[model samples]
Target: MNKQLSWLRLAATLVTGALAATGALAEDGPQAEAGSAPPEASAASAARHCVAELAPVNAGARTSAIKQGGCYSSFAAAMAAATDNTVALASESSPESVGESDLAAAATRVIGIDYDGRFYSGSSFIWYARNNFGCFGGRSYTANMPGSFNNRLTSTRGFNGCTRNTSYSGFFQTGFWVRCFPNCLYIGDFMNNQTSSKRWAR
Candidate 1:
């Protein structure tokens, strides 16, 4: 029995090592590189698969880029629920949409991420891939904070985070597991001021 357990442990370790090698775990570091290189085909496949798995999403959008309403719906089901205040913010900086730019004004346009309020309401993040790519978004408040965060994403859309609704915490340590996108994202804490980020491929 001891020997059998040892072998099982070894197998588990090997699997974990392989996952770590493939950028599966999140607690440690950034997944990819600094280059704005395109994603792999396998990534496209994975993205599609994730889309079907996370359906009604229509395979394009990001965290809290929309608003919510209607009867009985998953957050992903409502597409236009968010407004790209971040995009408006970037009218001066990245005004024109570039060629084949899966790279939207904000990563949210590319990857639909949203925060289902837990600790607080109205807190999120955004990354403006222009001006050599910069990520910015932060604040903590009651449900009222959305207005402030909205102005922030709109103001810095040229450059960071946009507000869709009430939230107070980054996507990072929010205790919810979400599939991130091409770029990495850091969701700060509501009160503890903790910042956590996830790096997703494609």
Candidate 2:
């Protein structure tokens, strides 16, 4: 009877060990499978950012215009997508006509362009505004950088009515502030890659 009892104990020990091994393998299997996916997913998500165009709805209305365009992979692509192709051609026979057309074009133009590298290299974000009324006669506009673009700007330029750029180190215009008059060929060390928000104005 003692020998039989001893044999039963040995059998139970082996069975318990086998079950524990199985449990460990089960836990490790899913973890191993899932580990490789997040990095790739994170990279793809990071690469996706957006570009936007803004405009007032109507003349003297202060808020009524058709805004269009969407996200793109590069600054050049975004610029192409946002540009107005239906611009009226100025009559070259009259210098006054060309001057008027140039003024009109400048009045409704890109508000700001931010670059990820100094000297305007690397990825870029273009903010185009229509009906801005030139640099001297437009309302101020402020915007927060997108999640992927926050703290990524290294250079910037403002145009049309938005000729002044103020970069903030925190979202919603908090933390440190740096002013870029008309443009910054390279954001200084303090603000380089540290901009999270921006304000544009005449």
Candidate 3:
């Protein structure tokens, strides 16, 4: 009888030990596995990723000479370098429409990027590619923009306004995202890469 009792206790202890081991493993599984990159790393990586994924324009209206400015690894770095009349690009949205030769012409165009669908007037800056590119400020508030972070957005307003709404064909939308406004509207979906913006009003 005592032997049987001893056997039963040993079995229980073994089962308990196995369960405890499993619980511990479960608790540490995520921590042990790879996690999201650091914030600074993520931001830098976004721009790099976008630039790396730049697809060549096969057949359509395209610009030229979009040089890879000093690839700033961080938004702080990009912001420090960001000036008025600069343009941002990303993996999701790149300079396919604007070619290498068109770089000069495209440079004058403040092609900001809007990764997410959010903006505020006269507060946020423009985002060309979420983490991909951080370009110049559209309006007089170029110096009032925020540091690029997570390749998301840096503006409180939708975006700078466009000069004219010139409609084109071939490409449905500009690969990148953007926002526009006559009375301050978020039109990144319908108006991205489709029109010319002036200030962050677009």
Candidate 4:
């Protein structure tokens, strides 16, 4: 009888261990698949790195943009200084190679302007996202900033002016501006910022 009891205990221990192992494997499956990032992430990483590299290319221009007021901060000036500045975009602003998002519900501390929108760091934001397998196609955020951002304005750009049209995918119920000029798209700053950000992201 004692021998029979010992054999039964051994059998139970083996069964318990097997069940635990199976459970662990099941949980790990989806997470492992999700871990398989898309190739875009690699590209985004490279882009961010390049942005950082370009900052030191010219020193005099940097000083000029700075010694004068921050009003005319060039692309380099914006990148070099970490201080928050209010930027204004022209009529009908649509960001490049990005998707539109609405975050008008979030509470934001006033960086400078009471422009009521939460903008993202457009270029770096999208580049990093695409490289990570998340993309919104050849569309920029389509929102309306009727002089104030009531939603997330991609938060990177202080403010840019854009007309909300469905064609550009700007058909949004809420109207808020995304800061493009001095914030994100300073005439091809996308590549530079993306390149530099690559190092930061990784």
Candidate 5:
């Protein structure tokens, strides 16, 4: 009888120890899984920081029309800085590529302006999408538009005494040809929040 009682006690103690070990593992399982989660999950929870690269727009006679605007490495960074309406310049343009977006809606803080350019950096804002992408080419051959070209264009002289257009067609249309300005066809204004504009013979 004594031997049997001792055997039963030993068995109970062993079972209890095994159960405690299992409980400990169960408790640690969730913590270990959580620690192994992907880094992107943490990044998604963090706030987005806006930084842009900028350069000066030099004007010897007339003050530059691009108020708070300048050369940005990328369009996305430019819009982020201008939308904030802060006076400080950006350190670098966002590495992300610019995409097609509704300026009026996305650029709540930025004033509405028109722009047109051959290259991506030509306008204060550049849509990432091609004209063939939006509205099935209803807005033909358009990529970028100037800020204030909705009005009549004026002829202005640059530093080298070369003539440039003060205004241009509102936006470039693709699929079909539409003339926005007759005398000064290609050049346009880089208005508020823009930095510098390149000379285009278009």
Candidate 6:
């Protein structure tokens, strides 16, 4: 019985050592797969608000960009769907037609969009003004980058009346300000990957 007990202890020790080694290897392994967002970015993307796509010619025709039965858990995945036109509206709402005036009005609500890659090639974040009221009449839009997105902006586009963008190197619109009027296909070296907060105005 003593010999059997010793054998059992040896087996348990071996198993524990193997598990520890495996865990160490996993910790030292590659953090993420190629072309995949980091775990923190994926989590941030899932936590953000869902995005909707508007028709290029007629913005009033909106479609949900989120997948059916599940939210987009990765910004890259969401951008892929947006680029490939694979997104569909929720089941409760079908596509609808709108008047020309409505389309024109709808087009002016989009304020800005930030991208993680140059020329808008990666994960994207968009901003919209409430009730189509853009940054005008002393109204402005501002926000600090989320934890995962901080220092991640590489490009940006501004539309409607919020064509003036001011990027800051610190949160709360502090630090050196880099101004990009209208749009920036690539935020220059001074501001690229250094933007922690931003503001948009007419």
State which candidate, 1 or 2, has the greater TM-score: 2
Task: Give candidate 1's error at residue 173 in angstroms.
Answer: 12
lDDT of 5 by residue, 1-202 (tens): 9999999999999999999999899878876576565876554333232222222223341222232234454444555554453222344543222222323334222222223332212333321211112222121111223333223222221111112222323232222222222122233344322323322112
Q: Give TM per candidate.
A: 0.18, 0.57, 0.34, 0.24, 0.30, 0.51
lDDT per residue for candidate 6 within 96-133, as digits (tens), equals: 21112322335335556676778754555655443455
Task: Point out where model 6 deviates above 4 Å.
Answer: 1-108
On TM-score, the candidate that comes out on top is: 2
Give the candidates in order of TM-score, highest first: 2, 6, 3, 5, 4, 1
lDDT value, candidate 1, whole model? 0.28
Instruction: Please provide, for model 4 over 52-130, each residue's C-alpha lDDT reduced to its tens digit, 9 standing for 90 to 100.
Output: 1111112223110111112121222222221222222332232331222221111211111111112332222211111
lDDT of 6 at 130: 36
> For each candidate, C-alpha RMSD in Å?
19.2, 10.3, 12.2, 17.8, 16.4, 11.8
Deviation from native of the Cα of residue 116 in model 4, angstroms? 26
What is the lDDT of every predicted structure here? 0.28, 0.64, 0.34, 0.26, 0.32, 0.58
Whole-structure CA lDDT of model 5: 0.32
Model 1 lDDT tens row, 16-72: 999887674443445444343456633322221001001111233333122322321
| Span of 10 residues, lowest total lDDT, candidate 2 | 91-100
After TM-score superposition, the amount by which residue 35's alpha carbon in candidate 3 deviates from its true location, in angstroms, is 8.0
Ranking by lDDT: 2, 6, 3, 5, 1, 4
Over 1-202, each residue of candidate 3 has an lDDT whose tens digit, in order, gives 9999999999999999999999899878876556768777665455521221111122342432133344444333333233333533332332112222323323333334332223321112333322222232322211111223233332222212322212221223333434333222344445432332222222
Better of 3 and 4 by TM-score: 3
Clashes of each: 27, 5, 45, 41, 21, 0
Q: At residue 4, what lDDT does model 5 achieve?
A: 100
